[model samples]
Target: MRNQLLAVLDIVLSARLVNANVIRIAEEAHKAADPHLALALVSARGTTTNPVEIALDLEMLDAAVDCAKEALAEIEKIKRVVSKNVVELEAAPSLPGGDAAMRRDAIQENLDEIDEGFQICGARLQEMETVRDIADKRRKALVARV
Candidate 1:
């Protein structure tokens, strides 16, 4: 029974860690997918024949694409971590005695949190993908103009 309690505690701690990671990744994704950054990429016109201006625009587009790709990768990591946590929660042993109900409740709460985190990550991933696509298109357009 003592071992079972310890196992439950370990699972809870692991779940908390996963949640923290998810939060961190979401923040990163939010920064990478900033609406202003996307707008800047979309609004930047390579119509000017100035070599310097075109080069600068290309550099900016490249940076945006890199950031978006990194964010997308981070989001994918979060998804995998969350999925693993869900599995752990499911496999956690029920505590003995009156604590059994409490353990079940804690597991359920962790699952709920993981589900919410997954949903949030999904939205962020979509946003990051959109930003990446816009940056790619803008970069191509700029390159073509050059």
Candidate 2:
């Protein structure tokens, strides 16, 4: 699940970043070019497709950010549950080579795995946020230009 979320997030972030950059360049072109040329560039040879593409990118970025946040929250919850179990396991006495000892080891292993997962999700969320911020800023700048 963690791997899947990370993969999805990576794809979304990459696409959003690229699209945002393209929109920014187009906006810049519009600002710097003459009236007729600006219109041609922004409308893509009079097709008026830039607005629709930008709108779609904005919508997808918003949805992806929301999904990443939810995934991070779910990871946090899992980490908390696993941490509590590990603590409880530690509080109990374990006989050498006994079942309790085995259980404790297993729980410890699970806790470690959860910790790794949390770290991965946290990093991915941070990266996604950075991309989202850049895209948003570019969008706002373009809007202001208009």
Candidate 3:
């Protein structure tokens, strides 16, 4: 019975870890999606005719996009683990200490957090992609002019 309880605890901890990671990634993605970044890109395009300056600006935008892509990949991996953890949590036997309800509640809370993290990350990624597209267009125009 102790072993069963420990197993459930382990699963809960694992799920919590994944949820934390998701939240961290979402936060990073939010930074990448900052309006200031988009505004800077636009300002660079409108105010700078120098190819070198434009190139540098585009590079910064590209880096943000790359960071967002990496975060997205990490989120996908975390999602798979979260799914497995949810299954394990559901199948966990009742704890010996009569804390099964507590465990269930924790699992549900973690799941909710993970879901919210995914939504936030998704929106941020979309915003980052839109910024990247604008940078791409500017870069192409610069290339054509040179």
- Point to the candidate with the largest lDDT: 3
The CA lDDT of each predicted structure is 0.59, 0.50, 0.71
As a TM-score, model 2 comes out at 0.56
TM-score for each candidate, following the candidate numbering: 0.58, 0.56, 0.76
lDDT of 2 by residue, 1-146 (tens): 45534543443344344334434433443333233223323333324334445455555555555655565566566556655555655555553456445555665665566566557555655655555455555556556777
Off by over 4 Å in 1: 35-58, 97-146
TM-score ranking, best first: 3, 1, 2
* Model 1 C-alpha lDDT per residue in residues 32-136, reported as the tens digit of each score: 556545554444533444445545544554565566567556656655665665566556655547564565566567556656755765665565455545545
* Clashing residue pairs, backbone N/CA/C < 3 A, model 1: none
Better of 2 and 3 by TM-score: 3
Q: Please provide, for model 3 over 48-73, each residue's C-alpha lDDT reduced to its tens digit, 9 standing for 90 to 100.
A: 66666666766776677677778878
* Residue runs of model 3 more than 4 Å from their true location after superposition: 30-40, 96-98, 142-146
lDDT of the structure predicted as candidate 1: 0.59
